[model samples]
Structure formats: structure tokens, C-alpha cells
Target: MIKLKRNDKIGLVFFLAFIISMSLVWLFEERFDQEQWRSNPGKRYKMAKNIIEQDLLDNKSKEEVIQILGEPVTAEFSDNNILIYQLGTPPSFFDEEPQELIIVLKDSKVIHVSVNQEE
Candidate 1:
């Protein structure tokens, strides 16, 4: 076996630690769940990434969206062809605004989906 210098050993340990920690994070990352979404609003941010990446809401009908995500936070936004589901405040050290899952619709079908901070 090759012997590493002290500094090289330290660097190797740190690199291995980073790889392990990142793997743990990926393993624990949340996936979208309808029940969890309706029950735990605060955890929506964890699942939002999955939804967008999978295009889960894309091209779905308005009623289908409601069935999947429950009702929008308010009806006022619906008039403008947008559905907003409050995702609660994201986990952050900085003062971050609450986020929302914005689903845009056209002709009563979903056209786009995104997670955006509430203004």
C-alpha cells in the first residue's frame, strides 16, 4: 500500500467525508407525495424539485391538478390562469420569503409549473 503524507491523508479524508455526506443528502431527499403535501405544507420545498423535474403537472387538466395538489391557496389567482400553492418558508439561514408552487394554465390545461418565492 502506498503511504500518504499527513496533509495528503487529511485531504483524502475530507474528500471522502464530502462524498459520503452528499450521498446521504441525495438518499434522504424528499419525493413528491400528495398526502404529505396536503398534511405538511412546510416540507413542500423538499418535494417541489421532483415535481418540476418530472413535469408531473404539465399538460394536466385543472381538475386533475386540484386532485393532485388539493385546492390553491386562494381563488383570486385562478382568474389570471394561475394556481398558487403555498410551500411555507424554505429551509435557509438567510431571511427567505415563503415560496409557492406556481402552476400556469391555458385553455383549462396546465402549461407550466415552477416554484417561486412569494413577493
Candidate 2:
């Protein structure tokens, strides 16, 4: 039979607590970042608007969007050759209230873009 000593039990308890705390921190960090981002919806919306207005929609590529917006929060490519660039808080935490930018691409070129701000 295997037996754990008193020190071993103490170490195990501490290790479990440490893991739980880390998991909680990791989960909450995303929520905190989203809260901070949503707090400035105007700024984020303006950024998206500028990307659509100034850039040449017909010639703009994915790389160009990245250059203009730094990076998107999420991206999705469909089988129908449509690419979507989503910016703002992820949907996991902000399920009911979420904001995002939808950039539609056709043949690797920007065809349409829309800023969706959920209230």
C-alpha cells in the first residue's frame, strides 16, 4: 500500500490550491481585458470605421487589414470563400452583449465591411 506522509499531504494541498488559483486567474484575465476594451467602444468603433473609409476596399488584402488594425480579435474563413474579421470582446464571456467588426472578403479582396456594436 502507498502512503503519503504529513509533509507530502501538505505539499499536495498547496499544489492543488496553486493550480486552482492559476486557472481562475487565467479565466478572469480575458474578462478583464474585454471589460477594458468595451469601456472604450467609441475608440474601437472609430478604428474600424477608419479602416473601411481610408483603405481601398477593392485592393485591400488581409495583410493590409492587419497592418491597419494591428490584429483582429477573431477571424473566420468559410467554405464559400468568404473571410470574416471580428474585433472586440470574444463571445464566450460576453455571450449576450458582444461587439464586433465584420469584414467580408471575396477572392482575397475586401468587398464589404460593417461595424456591429451591440448595446
TM per candidate: 0.76, 0.42
- So what's the TM-score on candidate 1? 0.76
Residues 8-116 of candidate 2: C-alpha lDDT, one tens digit per residue:
9999999999999999976654221334334564335434544556553446787775564445555665433334444555335546444567777776777887767
Q: Global CA lDDT of candidate 2, please?
A: 0.58
Output the number of the lDDT-best candidate. 1
Off by over 4 Å in 1: 1-22, 76-80
Q: On residues 8-118, what C-alpha lDDT tens digit does candidate 1 reach at each position?
A: 999999999999999998899888899999999887988899999989998999899999999899644536588889988986899688999999989989898998898
Q: CA lDDT of 23 in candidate 2?
A: 94
What is candidate 2's CA lDDT for residue 50?
Answer: 49
Q: What is the lDDT of candidate 1?
A: 0.89
Model 2: CA > 4 A from native? 1-42, 55-58, 78-98
- Identify the candidate with maximal TM-score: 1
